[model samples]
Target: MKLALILNVIDPKIGGVMIMGDRGTGKSTTIRAIADLLPKIEVVEDDVFNSHISDYELMGESIKEKIDKGQNINSILIKVPMIDLPLGATEDRVCGTIDIEKALTEGIKTFEPGLLAKANRGILYVDEVNLLDDHLVDILLDSAASGWNTVEREGISIRHPARFVLVGSGNPEEGELRPQLLDRFGMHAEIRTVKQPSLRVQIVEQRSKFDSNPYECLNEFEAEQEKLKRSIIEAQSILSNVSIDYDLRVKISEVCGELDVDGLRGDIVTNRAAKAFAAYNSKDQVEISDIKQVIALCLRHRLRKDPLETIDSGFKVKKVFENIFGSS
Candidate 1:
């Protein structure tokens, strides 16, 4: 799960990760903690949408207007916005509504930016996502794909940058998302509660220590966190230069085809994830080990399920990968 999060941060083009696990598994805690490790992003000053200062395509209409009028745009560095989307949120709340009162009184079209606006260029986390309304889920996936959200109401149309890594977690016991929707996520991480008593005790003790003295615990991990942050930033800088072998690419697709995956998304995400893993390890060339590490995470959830088949999806991916690439 941590690997998936790190890879997505390195290359948001890899899409985002879906985490499914049992209750009380700390999925939410881990996802939120990752925000702390990330480097701050630069945004146009006081811009609600976290618009990039120079990238016209990433800017909201207000920021673009400033650029068009040759106004000096002020910028500030801020932590990447991490917005939590609640289950009961309405369409207006998730996708910003037209400020009806402001529009009528001032005779101007104004948008009340919602969660999507705040989530631009950042992470949007939805806990219990499987229970979330399917309509809202569709809206989020659409925006994440298009990198923009359009809100049209009462003859007024508003569009803004909504690019964000969409991370979601759910308990499978409660329910499961439709296969079609689940396949949209770049990778799926399935976690289980620790079965061994010793490990469980250790985990409990660690949490207890943190609860007893949060500051002291944080201080202990500060150096390690900073080291990881530096690695992630460096990986991002060198990701474009990372190269995957041609044979490896063909084999990655072959594995996907052999699994009878529904679409090419599985193949594409696997390639990007392998490269991201190579970059994460500070290697310019992707190795078989890198692909081996990420291929299952990228393709497991994409496989077409057979009611009669007993094989695990992840195991099947590995088996195919081994067949195509040969055990190295």
Candidate 2:
């Protein structure tokens, strides 16, 4: 559900999500499924940086050289990035680095772009994120915030657009991530194993059918898939028309202040999430109901420590939201 809301906000300006869940909860599967359902985007065929097909004329000379050589300049619709960043991945693997082979063989000063380059304008999904290196996390955060990737090595400097939504997943029982990195995410969600008998049965049955006859199962769900795709496209089409009422802005700030959230991120993220929610609902204007629906998703992880005993920050967000906006 939270993923659907986040998908509706997949502009270059919006941040990504963090999902914490237990094993066997199908975290990876759900991410893959949602990604599979996303509509293909047009990109320059055979381009390493994955530049949009529509933006080819503005591309750098290096990319344009391939086109100039008659290297098949047709635009192709390809699936967006759904990269999985596993543990033990090195910095050179995640960020661009000196192209050793080119330097050694041709005496050419060149760069080898890495996963981050491939993930430009796409989703960089990280599983077991708690175990990842902090420096890598910082690289991701920097690129996301600045919408560019900068790398310098072996007397060569490179910078390219690296806008992406970082979808990070981890099991909290194994370890914890630093607060600074966690706060960078736009939204957070928690998932667990299904406890209800009927729900569990339904889930298992669906998986079994998919496993047994994948094509048939996909055919059966084709209508639903197209529906979801249309909704996302529709949401994107209307997102530019959504606006925030001034009073609602005050209410958002009030709730964040009441919770004693760390920085203005809580306020900013809530505002963005509300706008996306309104867009998803086909509303040109944001309403308090939109904010109310998404406040918890935006601020759940941004809350300060509670003076009281253990309590979910989401619950606290709901309480503060109702108190400020009057549960309308």
Candidate 3:
């Protein structure tokens, strides 16, 4: 269910998710699996940041001049990047800066791509996100929301595409993001340790088998993985055709209103998420069930009117949604 939302950001721009939980859960594992099961992206060859061809046309003078006159800018397919952001990374490491060699040798300023640049149009998975530097987290939220990364240093400024799914996971026991940063995420999900006896045993057995023979495990799930990837690709292809009905939109609006959501983000995110789910399911339009399916994800991180009290935000969201849209 959560993976569907991450894939949604790839095509529908539904925005990123914040995952909070204890350690040793499947949070990171599931994210990696989703990344591996996804399709490769076609990017302009030699584009250090894997920027799209359209974006390359409007690139800076230095990058534009690098290409030969009348030279066809060819495209190449590469695996979609899955970048990991360690909590200890600095701003210079995450946002990059002017290339020192270019400035010294040619006396020209060139922007060096950073982790965020490499994560462009892909996934930026941050482990222990709550423990990250506040400044770094601010930059991530800003870049993810604005879809552009701009760095300024030594009187040189560079801007480029920074659009991507900002998947952040952290152990809540260690710490929590400030309300402001929490609200910045489009969605939030809680990862819990598996407690089902049968499921726990199955998980251990699967891990044992994979450890004994990794290649065998990959082959075993290759077909299923390929099929899931195809569904994502096909959904992205026909995403434009999937629309939300007027009544459903109103229901979404009403639900948000009843919840006393912060600004219009809850409403907007819910709409986008619902549409993405519909498209993923090969539906031409969104249904009430689709809206209900994503309402919790969309509203879980937002603030409520009774901020002084501690309440389960997910339950509140479900309550509001069910009240308006009826039980599923």
Highest TM-score scorer:
1
Question: What lDDT would each prediction earn against the true structure?
Answer: 0.93, 0.79, 0.80
> Could you give me the TM-score of model 2 versus the true structure?
0.91
* Runs in model 1 lying further than 4 Å from the true structure: 101-106
How do these models rank on lDDT, best leading? Answer: 1, 3, 2
lDDT of 3 by residue, 1-328 (tens): 3554454554636668888887888788887777776777878787777767656633434446556355567778998888999878989999988987788799987777789888887889898888898889999989988888899877778888787788888888997898788888888888788889999999999999999999999999999888877888877877788898788888888887787776888888888887778878899888888887788988877855464877788888898788888887
* Candidates 1 and 3 compared by lDDT, better number: 1
Q: Given candidate 1, what's the lDDT at residue 109?
A: 95
Largest lDDT belongs to which candidate?
1
Which 10-residue span in candidate 2 carries the lowest summed lDDT?
A: 3-12
TM, every model: 0.97, 0.91, 0.91
| Candidate 2 lDDT by residue in tens digits, 69-187 | 86756767889777777788898888878886787799887877888888876778888888899999888888877777878876667777776778788998988688888888888
Count of backbone clashes for each model? Answer: 0, 0, 0
lDDT of 1 by residue, 1-328 (tens): 9999999999988889999999998999999988997999999998889999999878998888889999999999999889999999999999999987787799899888999999999999999999999999999999998899999988889999999999999999999899989999999999999899999999999999999999999999999999999999999999999998899898888898898998899989999999999999999999999999999999999987888999988898999889888888
Q: What TM-score does model 1 achieve against the real structure?
A: 0.97
Model 1: how far residue 231 lies from native, Å: 0.8
